[model samples]
Target: MRPSSDRQAPGGGPRDFAAAEWTKLRSLRSTWALLALGTVLTVLVSLLFCALIGPEFRRADSAQRRALDPVGLTFTGLQFGQVPLVILAVMAVGNEYGTGMIRTSLAAIPRRGALLTAKLAVLGATGAVWGLLTGAVALTAGSTVLGASVPLHTDAVRALAGAGAYTGLLAVLAAALTFMVRRSLTALGVLLPFLFVVSGALAATPQLRSLARLLPDRAGLRLTQVHQDAGDLSPAAGGGVLLLWAAVAATGSYVALRRQDC
Candidate 1:
């Protein structure tokens, strides 16, 4: 009996790169763990904070005790949850390069661009699902305790949708940057400090608030809050900035891949 062929011709039939990537994504434990961690952190931490605020916390306007934006406060942990998403995204793409599996992936496809796209699609879809599930659960649980202080309206819906989108985008952008950097620790070191440390510092400075509005996570944070600063960047602008970052990172990775002879 003839042995089965393991090779696919270049530029042949529908590629099915999506299927290939889906298998790879699902096979990884880090992906699922990070997602679960993000959800738990968002829902549990937010709930704990709400409970701590209790009935004693009243607003200056006599609106209601614990009159904070329930929706926003509920999704507050996403700010921290985003860190794991970044780590997961980085590991997702970086693992291939780190393990030299990227060469094998390119060998199977022979078209590096197609391989990258497949990876992007898989990561993006996974992120979207993770974001939606986490946001929904957290919102539902947190709002139950917040009561009438939280409004049920179109604005609230938009904020929930925005949170999901932001989480997903965070994953994609981080993955792209990982591909560009091609090193797990290097990407994490650079991105973490920039997003968490640098952005936090800048946010504290009055003069830099306008500039800080341009930060990636800051724009994403707007998705959870009903009220935004006058100087804050719009969600649309934030999406554009993220897209630009993704594009640059992806392009850089592609160029490096082609030139590095890997």
Candidate 2:
């Protein structure tokens, strides 16, 4: 049988490129390891958050209790879970550049845009599937722990689907940034702090709250909330903001890839 990479369209069509990219991604052990870690973290953190909610709700006043969001509680783990996914996205594209495999890839598939599109498509799909699985598991575990308090309603379903889309968009954004910087560590350095520290800090500051809401992480995560604050954007609008950020990053990455030599 011919080598798998040798099997492609006459000129390496999009489908062929996507197949090759999937093969490459699946061959890496790190991909499975990171995804597994992400799932575990998401579920564990969600369960922990759910466990606390009952006690907290009991202690709270009526107004505070009224403000509680069971659907949102199930996704509390995503704050930690998304870190591994960011690493996964960064490594996916960064590793190729790190080891000079990008040169070989570029040589085999001269159309940089086609190669990038295929890679992003595969990465985005993987992220989405993993995100959905993580969200489902977390929601199930959280519901079991929280009992009747956690409603399995339309909003819950939206939150579950939103969790998947949020993670997928985040992964694409990270990958595109990796492509632009051409270094995994550099991308991680900037992105990790921005997501974890800067975004949270900015969101907490009265002066910066509006600006913070526009951030990709801050805006995208709004999708997982069943209850929105008075000033918060609707889930659909928040998703749009994230999608715009990913698009901008992708465009910048493409420009960098096309202009720079491998």
lDDT tens string, model 2, 170-233? 9999999999999999999999999999999999999999999999988998888877888898
Model 1, 165-187: lDDT tens digits are 78777777787777777889989
**Backbone clashes, each candidate:** 0, 0
Among all windows of 10 consecutive residues in model 1, the one with the lowest summed lDDT is 58-67
For candidate 1, the TM-score is 0.86
Question: lDDT of all the models against the reference?
Answer: 0.74, 0.88
Evaluate model 2: give its TM-score. Answer: 0.92
- Cα lDDT over the full model 1: 0.74
Give the poorly placed runs of model 2, Cα more than 4 Å off.
1-9, 58-66, 149-151
